[model samples]
Target chain A: MDVRRRNNVVVTGPEDGPVLVLAHGFGCDQNMWRLVLPALARRHRVVLFDYVGSGRSEPTAWSEERYSSLAGYAQDVVDVCEELDLRDVAFVGHSVSAMVGVLAAQAAPERFGALVMVAPSPCYIDSDGYRGGFSAEDIDELLASLESNYLGWSAAMAPVIMGNPDRPELGEELTGSFCATDPEMARIFARTTFLSDSRGDLDGVSVPTLVLECAHDAIAPREVGAYVHDRIPGSVLVTLEATGHCPQLSAPQATAAAILRFLEHPR
Target chain B: MCRTEEDPEPREPDGAKDGDRTTDAAFSALLEDSVEELYESAPCGYLSTLMDGTIAKINSTLLEWLGTDRETVVARKRFADLLTVGGRLYHETHFAPLLRMQGRITGVALEMRTGDGGRLPVLVSSVVKHSGDGEPLLIRTTVFDASARRSYEQELLRRQREAEEARRQAEEARRQAEADRARLTEALAALQRSLLPAELPVVPGLETAVHYHTASPDRLGGDFYDLFPLDGKRWAFFLGDVSGKGPRAAAVTSLTRYTLRTAALHDADPAGALGTLNTVLHERYTGDDPRYCTAIFGVLEPDRDTGEVTVRLASGGHPPALVTRADGTAHFLPTPGGLLVGVLPDPHFVTATTVLAPGDTLLLYTDGLTEARTGPDRTDLYGDEALHAFATRLAGPPPGGLVQALTALLDSLGDGVDDDTALLALGVPARPGAM
Candidate 1:
């Protein structure tokens, strides 16, 4: 497996600068970091890649068994880091990718320098005492919506789904402006991402970490964010003024500033 | 303007003036009251949110459905805050991002948390309103009750799951039926084997070998053969086939086998033994379920002085025997006109006498050998001519070798051999020190 081809790796900035790897969440690909890239790319060597089943990555790399859990996604991240031979890397993850990055860092702690989890939740379902924001029933409804909406997306994305390399026009039709994704891939990825329980993985993190929680985030509520911060030892928790789930897109300046502040101050 | 002069002013009628006054008052009432009435009590809920999902304005009807007043919902709670915990997660992840990217989204299903803590299933549509300078201003949203649609969707999901479960169970049943049939076939196979001799009685001077081939795995075949000693000097051997297959044919096969052995005890002649078997079968099955058999019974008498075997074989509608001589030559010992045994009480049974000296072999078999199918489609038969041709090539092999070679040929025929077959070979070993 060619890691760069599978993840659609894009590397920029000074090669000598400290590496910054950005992993996007479930909905979109690396395009989610477009707003923050401009501000952060100047000072550090920025690295970005799409998960195997998402965005411009090789579509054929998806295997139902391998991708049934988030471990497969973390393996892809580790592959990219290993392929580039980057060490002590600063990793930024948004949404579900935050847990994905955590797993990757845990597998290879020497390669990861620090972790910045943006609006991350270790789990999405509510347990005995934990308030992870959503219920198991809610997740089912979300899966139902995915299936219902996929009827249209599948028709339009059939060509791309078959991985036809000869017809560039059909591929263009699939990867049009927004977060264009294969419907089946999106559905499976959505299930894998939300249904995962990584609360047990938080304590094993050895890297310096920052948990960036936004005000009134629906996907990861204030309590969920705080829960993640409390679980990880010696980790800093920063509450941003930015609202909603995606501050990277909505308030990129504030998001980037918080990240830069964390990077500048080692302690 | 100066000519505004009032020359020729007409007088107004009292009835017309009253009508004009009534129409003017009705138009004024429509303009004044309907606007507020339509905004407050419309069928669907209406609300406007700023870019951050904050609820800026909400109508009375929406407020009433949410069971909350305008002030509590207005600036204090965001539109997303009015949603249930699950709905908020969905709104934040998919709904809001889609609205931001597409500028408008329609028919999005979500549940709003009412003030009474009950959930309201609603279908929402929102459009991002823009300022005149093309800057993003506010998001205007409309909500409709989707309670009925929700219940219908739930019912559909339940039915789909039930259908999948039914299909899974049906597949399991089919597999079970196949397993049961296999077990029954195995039992029938064991029963069929019980009708034949487990081991041949050793003749002092003759080498004997036999093979039985069953065409199907799941049903009992009709072919059976046995070799047993008649006395100290003579041996009785018979190879026969009943008419059909399965349990009924199996019954007839067992009856014929025992009748042959008993008849041979009383008479040393092959023809006399077959006569007894024919009468037994003809008497037992005289009704609608008539059963019949084709058989060849032979008596082998070894001469100790000459080192030769005298074989008298009586054929009853069976294929002729093949004799391979000492000089490596083969020919059919034709018993031309013998009628099938068990079909009639007095069937013609013919005896073909042959001598098996040193290096001579006599092979007896049922018609299953010659009448076996030759091709995959079974369109061609391994007729008497083909068997004759194949036997001539096997002139040098002894009894055991002949049986083994023919079994290999049967295996190569694959699906072509659709009937059960039984073979019995008797070879006289070459005289010691003859070379």
Candidate 2:
């Protein structure tokens, strides 16, 4: 399949502007960038695409082998860049996609210029000398909660989680509706997102990176933000006063401002 | 009706003023006593926190549950300080942000730490109290005992684990059954191999080859063949097919083989040996369950002076033998009008005599050879016509070459051979001057 159709890529803004690719995280599709896109697209060319099995992307492309690791997802990003002939692209990733962006930048350094990780964590579970702010048991509980609460009536619940303005048409066409993903796909993605360990990949990133951590974020705590910043060489750490895991939805202006400020300064 | 400042007490008289004063006093007393009692003795715990999580006010019920007094909780401890370490982390990350975005959170499960460092599982629900203009003023929270609910969830988790373990054990049992079946197949294969000769004996001035094909490994097929020297000059060989398979058929095959060898040693004639076998089988199986077989027995005598091998073969309800000439022409040496070997009391076995001259080959085989299906739908057999054509394609090669060609033909008929086949080829190699 053509990469644009497979990933459901949507590009908008001025024709000659700098490219900014926005990747949504585990729960939502590209619609997670709905709040930040207006401000972001004003200055730069904004690109939004869904991962396979999410949003308007082709679910048929999903396979257990292709999505067994984050590297496969990084390849999707690179494929999109190659298809569009985009070079030195700015990448904005939320939650798990933050690490996916890191992997993509490492895989094809020429394709990426800057990396922005929102509420990112190198690891989710606590290890020796590391504070990821979650226990294995807590993640299990979260999975159980997702199974019990989401799968039963996912189509109706997705719009609420996406929380976009009244675009019911967009909601109807999504694969299984819940965060624009099949319930089974969401469960697998959740496990892959929460159980991954991308700590070793941090040191290999040569691009300018910004680590955005929200205050009072339960998923990725302040210490995790600090840890990621320290591992990624020459990466800038910015703490948002917005109090949630999804600052783009809760406080769009501040979230966009932090990203814009980071892009303006080189180091 | 307007009352000026001078007449501000126009409506109040001395009797009314006294009555109002007593009612007001009683109402104030009730309000003062009940408010403190309700706040201190509510069924659930109550607490209020500033935006920064510092506890501003706490009720006696909450303080008692935490094993801490009012002095320690109020203004000294933040609301997160009363929670367990993991719960505190959850509160700071997930709960606090959720509350800020949603303006309220309910039914959050957490554990609170007591003064003596014991934990109490509780369900917490909190809301941000807002001023008139929708500004969040303070955090108000309520805690409910969740020990019973926690135990119920634990029970469910245990049952789920038990079910998973049961499924795993069942899968293991299935795997074990498969392994056992594989072992049984191996044992059957060994038994089948034991029924065949370890190696064929070498004959003077003759080239010979034999092949036996089994339809399945689950049960032994009832096809047998043997080639042995009767004396110094003559060799006896037989190929046979029993009517059925498995242990009973295997027993009959063993009996038939020994009877043919013994009878051939004494009789020296191919037809006479088959006659002896028929008589013995008819006598042994006169009971209710009848058993039968089709067989071809042969005597090979090589002529050293003329470089020719004379083959005498007897057929009892078996396919005719094929003699492919030195010139690559093939035809059946027909032995018709013979009865099944083990059925009739006085079965007549017919003998066919042919010479396996230099470069000539004689093929003695069971009907399973010509009866193998060859069509795509498997409705048609590799009949006499096809075998004739196949032998012709061999170009009258020596015994080994013919056997190899037949083996390739059998290999090409995969999933089509429904019965066992035994073939014996005897040929006198072409003389250097004869070619």
Best by lDDT: 1
Worst 10 residues of 1 chain A by lDDT: A161-170
Error of 2 at B118 (Å): 4.3
Return the lDDT, model 1, position B295: 88
- The iRMS of model 2 comes to 6.4
Give a tens-digit lDDT track for model 1, residues B1-435: 001112423234334555588866665555564445655666888888888988998889899999999889889989988987667766776677656645566667788888888989887877777676655688888898888876776677678779989999999999999999888878886887788988888898999999887665645768888888988998988998999876888899999999999999999789988899999999999889899988889999999998899999998888888887776778888888988888887988988999999888888877667777786555688787776677678765678888888888888777767788899999899777642
Sorted into a CAPRI-style docking class, model 2 comes out as incorrect
Q: List residue ranges in candidate 1 displaced over 4 A.
A: A1-17, A43-45, A52-68, A83-85, A125-130, A134-197, B1-44, B115-118, B130-135, B148-220, B224-238, B247-353, B357-363, B368-435
Put down candidate 2 lDDT per residue, A1-267, tens digits, no spaces: 989999999999887988999998776678677667889999899888989877678889988777768888888899999999998798999988999999999888988999999999879999999888778876775565444333223443333335422233334343334344665676677678778999999999889999999886766889999999999889999998865578886678899999989888848
State interface RMSD in Å for all models.
Answer: 7.0, 6.4
Per-model chain A TM: 0.91, 0.92
Question: DockQ winner among the candidates?
Answer: 1
- Write model 1 residue lDDT over A1-267, tens digit each, in one string: 788998889998888888899999987778778768988898899999999888888889988877778999999889999999989899999999899999999888889999999999999989999998778888887776655444344443332234433222224433453465776788789899889999999999888899998986878889998899899998999998877999886678899999989988845
**What is the fnat score of candidate 1?**
0.20
